[model samples]
Target: MSNDMLRSFFLGGFECSSHRRADGVRLDLLRTTTHDVLAGSDYRQLQNCGISTVRDGLRWHLIEVSPGQYDWSSFLPMLRGAAECQTEVIWDLCHYGWPDHLDIWSPEFVSSFSRFAAAAAELIRSETGRSGLYCPVNEMSFWAWAGGDSEKINPCATGRGAELKRQLVRAAIAATDEIRKVDPQARFITAEPLINVSGGSGDQAWQTEAENYRLSQFEATDLLTGCLEPELGGRIDNIDFIGLNFYPDNQWYLGGSTIPLGHHSYRPLSDMLVEAYERYRRPLVISETGAEGSAAPAWMHYVCSEVEDALRRGVPIKGICLYPVLDYPGWENDRTCEVGLLGTPGPGGERQVHHRLLDEMRRYGHLSDLARKAGSFADA
Candidate 1:
């Protein structure tokens, strides 16, 4: 674990997705959470809580209105806000949304995306003089399953999971290549669902099926680094950092049952981190990890403890990002999901802090330093 890698040991993220639902209803999470309007204040709040690094997004569909045109009107202000607040951001170029004219499966899609990524990188470099940190396209495996196979979101095509995964991997690789051409010092983060699937029933056949599901989690990164798909224009250098998005329901039985984090059958998250490190030998980050309301503090405690355990075992964990640091409406139904350290915004744009989660964050910050101190003493 290195504090020098990011602006803060703990990072915060805003939910900035612009995905369209299966029924053609498009979502603008930034708008719902009011981050679009209050970027400066929101970032300022995070900084006050000791998090100067954040994850944010640019709505590609809104910006890339036409084939070759990009209107930075929507994203520029947020970038400026981050600069104003002295926040370091890992910008998500595409968070499950694209322009209407683009077909994700077509070759033109890859070309258009590459152009967009390069232009975006150049824009950031010119506007802020920062060597960019970006997740080119967020959660490829999750997107493929949720949108492509299950028909939950845009470009909803059923039974095309494998095809969609390949297309996304191709587009990401193309974007990475072009982005580097524009900004060679840029760092790329490949974030995908990190899950462990199992057969609650101990039948050998069901166990094998569960293993297959679990292994699919690595497809995106493997494809990016050319381990899975060498023909898809992947190269080893494409992998800079490994980002894993883990949550409560991440580990489950293939038959739709969950393995709660602390249950006897639940696998230790530190073990999962070790597995990932052994696979790629890359620096890791918990790109997204948070739970709603009262569960937030406990969930964060579990994650942070596992992170420390991973650190003790020599895993190069960069940092952990608390995703959606602002409360937002649920995607499926418009119910308020009481996630984030900050509550819903008020008339004057003030937010109430979740004292529980904040306490957990502070405690862990103290403990991380204590662990390091103890390790140094042991070495001495």
Candidate 2:
């Protein structure tokens, strides 16, 4: 696919995490933010900011209610809304949650996921006359760490992070294959966290461990590209876009506090982007990036500046997505996280726009236009 595949250079990511919390309450962020009910208007809001492309999700638990049966009732409206608004979306099939009936460790989980993905692809093709872009699984590494290693979320276990990560990779590869069978033109994205880990202490062992931990960030994508584990049915073609989700808290000392942006240990986002592009040689996207209230505008400026620098250095970054474009309730608590350009919906389904972030978006929208022209030159 060309670098211009996405409709816009900037994108809005609707928070669609559907993971169960420690209290056994399954959290659906899309519903929490009311984006599911107001998806059409939500898309229009982004469009007004010149963001025609978006990152959205299909809640697997809601769609695959039973073993073989599928229900799109919870998802169709959002899909139709995007279509109605003339929005381009990269749909995430599994966003950290699954149906309660399936054991995440079982072989059945992989098979069921593949089948569901194929069904979703079929539905998209039928409704929109295009297979579209999809992210088969979101943040496998983080999910494994939170849910399997740390007991912070569902399928809570201890000392099984690696095992869970491999299982998610298998499921992702299976979903890609199945989706391809249904929609041959479909493209896939691997939306993983881009992180930096620094050894705060001078100990050699600490530095070594920190380096290993940092390298582990690429494990999921490496497996998908068949670079590390070929037995999982991974291939180079499985991922067309490398989606890196970065935020202020992404970089940190291995066992200490976060390394603030200006800290010497803090790696520039441009350098990380180039490193990833060189490793995978695939088009990249800032799949998710944003900051909470009061910090949003400055954060966008920083990210856009870094992205432009990376672009100048020959990195093919397709876009930067402002994640959770609509503020939503936090997973661990019900408090609103003021991290989006749009606030919670009102009685009439209207959302309050964060003028500062909107101003920054207007200022940086030209970056996409410039990148598109440059891409045309490169293509020629």
Candidate 3:
């Protein structure tokens, strides 16, 4: 791959959730904690390790409590700090939850979110000027699966079939449209998980189901980009770039030979990038790609190398992001996943594993070493 085409490394930032206290809110503190620590530890680690961009999601639910009321006190400072650190950010507006009052299917919810998105775009532009990226909604397919099909998040409506998918698409459209209105030049990287499924007869069925699940994500993007059949008045021109979030277990199966099989099983990140490129024909980014536990660094290496492979294959891959710079609490379970480059925080704010993955990232020279080795062999 040419040097001009190799995009910068993307590091994940903190993710906040509810569990508020009167002092402020739990999620807000979580963001603050990450900002402080990154400013101290992770920022230098990223710079020393050769990462140039940072990716973090700003929860709509946390920032906006009521319809018109806004709270920038907690989020703005973090963005400013990131900018000062010379790290570019891909701001994710909505991940999985909404403000306590907004219903996904409600007109009020749609209109309110549109206004919120526009306001956010304006603020980001006004604050950062022209050097800002936005992801109005993160993981549309995951949201559909969790809230609509799987009953995981708030307003957990499940088994609703296409209705749930439609709701997600509408929400994305509303958010994207409003953001574009505020900053017409705003670049967007819409992050959605790319789940690969495998197994036997039951596994095949599961894979089929998983593919359908995956379709919801691309479908929303396709609809937004005018690539799919118009489901909601042809509002498909809103998507600019594609952000793919893939995890190790994101590729799974539910039945038959409980043990999964196939080259798809633990797919190399290259294949995922190629899939997105083939489907969308636009610039693609690995928005949130990482593994859990001590394997995180090795996984980061493998995924980043795969990204280089895809670039060599002529895929218009834009960037690779190691999501969640700090190891925050997981939603699936309370245990710390330790997926970040800097290890998870220990009890009472102690750093446990220092530079566990970040050090490895430096050892490999940010995966550029691997890419050079591969290129040399290809030339030979």
Candidate 4:
């Protein structure tokens, strides 16, 4: 399917993660980064950078203060700001955390999430006079591994990663169905991590283990497409696009260090993109990708180069989103992570632009414009 519905091929994503820490402290990145209060200025900044599309989230825990009741006060401003700026937003319905009153293991969790999605669809259409684009559950595979298996965040359970993954897939499917009932034109994106794992040594058993670990990255996506678990009400039509979240550390060796970018075992991201496209026959997006400090510019350059290569190979690569477009505090240590095009917001929510990275983006934007004009990657 084509992703031409988006207004821009380049997008900015605010750090809207609302997951809780292992210590049971809820982490509201929106508040810590002051984006909750500065969304208007933030969208305006994206427009200045030539980005008319964005990926952001609505805090489900904050919106549904109580069951069957919602307080749109938290999300209304951001939604209106996007509309006013003519920015297209692909909203994340559930980033990581959910209302504490419901048990994630219970059936009520799926039903409640579906209901909330339905309500959100209605609200967005009523306000914007258009159907919404959504990511029902963000990074289900990572969420399962971190929160369910490793106990790194909320619902911090151990030894239940597979179960948690199935639950999340079920919720996503239910949410998609409910949203379609409200607005049949609504589209859903499945944003999952894109990773590669290789064997570090010559041991045969270790090689098999590494390969198995590598392939496990597709479990969540496979389930969603009914390739693994059809009993969960999954089908091919459940997802409209596949959003792959890649980063510098996405490739590694089993139980070993990260593979350097130029290492022999480091697979080119273009190949990974092609593999994903062939496997699902769906258009893809670089949903979340960025780096911190001095490495940010180079990382952006690499991703864009790889994406262009994939596009040239007939892969339906749609867009590239510079995630967490604004600098924010780290989840573990509260240290400032300088990983965005814009630095920390000042007292008035003004941010210092990373001129070098912005320049690279602009350079790539010009190339993309030329490509579009030439009818190259036009459908992509």
Q: What TM-score, computed on C-alpha atoms, does each candidate reach? A: 0.95, 0.97, 0.81, 0.96
- Using lDDT as the measure, which candidate wins? 2
Residue-by-residue lDDT tens digits, candidate 1, 179-238: 999899888888798998877767898888889989989988899899986999887788
Q: Candidate 4 vs. truth: CA RMSD?
A: 2.2
The number of clashing residue pairs in model 3 is 5
Q: Which parts of model 2 are misplaced by more than 4 Å?
A: 1-4, 373-380
lDDT tens digits, residues 112-211, model 3? Answer: 8778888888888888776357776666666666667665665566787356666666666777777777787776677777765554345566667766
Best first by TM-score, ranked: 2, 4, 1, 3
Each model's C-alpha lDDT?
A: 0.87, 0.90, 0.63, 0.88
TM-score of model 4 relative to the true fold? 0.96
Worst 10 residues of 4 by lDDT: 367-376
lDDT of 3 at 160: 71
Tens-place lDDT per residue, model 4, 140-166, is: 999999989999987899999999999
- Residue 202 in candidate 2, Cα distance off native in Å: 1.8
Scanning candidate 1 in windows of ten residues, the lowest lDDT window is 371-380
Clashes of each: 0, 0, 5, 0
Whole-model lDDT, model 2: 0.90
Better of 2 and 3 by lDDT: 2
